[model samples]
Target: MVIPTFETTFAVPMTCEACIKDIEGSLKQLNGIQKISANLKEQLVSIEGTAAPSAIVDAIQSTGRDAILRGSGKSNSAAVCILESHAPHVENKVRGLARMVQVAPNLTIVDLSIRGLSPGTYHATVRETGDISEGPESAGAIWEAFKAKEGTACRGVFGTVEVSKGGVGTVFLDRPIQIWEMIGRSIVVARQEDGKFDKNDPDTLVGVIARSAGVWENDKTVCSCSGKTVWQERQDEVGRGML
Candidate 1:
């Protein structure tokens, strides 16, 4: 059986009942048998079950919001999460919320509390992309890949994992995303222009996969899960609304 835990921040503003209800519906359909609890006031969630926490997370994430898993321990009372985005306006916000709901409609999701966090602030949206124990033999390679990152710091989390490399210029979680490591090795290859090469440039492989996964600038991406590399289903609405 899998006992999952997390501590994360949501970037979106969570100051109303509608917001709570909105996220709650996102996690209800994840592929697992489970018991779950969410604390909106403190921004947390807790679950005990036979499924991987990442499964729950990827489901919650389809709602266009980031769900990061922080730390886990047996017998801890509270699980925490953070909101990571804010809408451009009222109608756009509504549509964004709807997209989140549409991403994972059947997981057992609960929207905990929203405190004094700023609106539109992007934070670490981590979740385990690993597995609890390889499910039935019928599951595919994607499941196999996700199940591999469990228990480590990457459990139930994906995307831009923060690395605390030592330096005065680096005290934050803005490092390269850990998901890129899932498939193969990442090389620091750079595209050059002018008389010098720019090392601070974004690479290509990540862009290729992200675009393939429906997250290109013009794509309406849902959960940027570690394995969602191909745009399997098309979304009706696609636009670059906000970051």
Candidate 2:
């Protein structure tokens, strides 16, 4: 029998390695927790296993730390990344998250938030596919191309979020769009303040968040080859068998 697994990301406020150990200790008690990794810089926790999302979130919260479900590549899609400086001479300490909820078939609500950024107005937009092999940009590359026109990526611009002196802000877009439209795409937060996608200047880009999957797909699918699901069979057969 093959045991299936699921991956989920959580926004966790971890100040140090102790916090990560505490979270891991708490979650390790639960069955099906295959792996857990904490990204302190991004303040995010990534877990891969067969455990339930709620169970994992609850376990993390039990450690006396606040936790938010960034995205699970399931139900509602989510993407997360730490904002990086476009200018080599500058340093960025911002963290960004983008989540899409399917309220209706034709309409989706995009929720975005960023922390530890300079206090100011920022623009959010979706560019063309990016190259994710470049560290944080690896996932960010999902939506790196920006060809600003009237109704193209500009239309995907959710809006702006203002970071206060404390370096936190949020923006959202409640419009008509399908879940499939955003799956495997990327969301970008820019400090340019123009609300326009400028392909000419790379400095306009600030941070990026990449959604791993779409909500339209049933993330939890099973197969009946002696309890081996389709995904499991594919995994087993990959690079090891002749058809």
On TM-score, the leading prediction is 2
- Winning candidate number (lDDT): 2
TM for candidate 1 is 0.27
TM per prediction:
0.27, 0.45
Q: Positional deviation of 222 in candidate 1, in angstroms?
A: 28
- 35 Cα displacement, candidate 2 (Å): 30
Instruction: Give the whole-model CA lDDT for all candidates, comma-separated.
Output: 0.28, 0.57
Q: Per-residue lDDT of 1-243 in model 2, one digit per residue for the tens?
A: 232455667767789999999999999999879889888987778888756555676698799976656456455444433344344443432255555544455555555656656688887765444433342243332232354455555445567778889876765465455656665445566665333444323333444444444322322335544677544554553322201
- lDDT for model 2, on a 0 to 1 scale? 0.57
Cα RMSD to native, each candidate?
19.4, 13.8
lDDT by residue for model 1 (31-112), tens: 4435555656645455444334345555556765555343332222212221212222223211111011101112112222
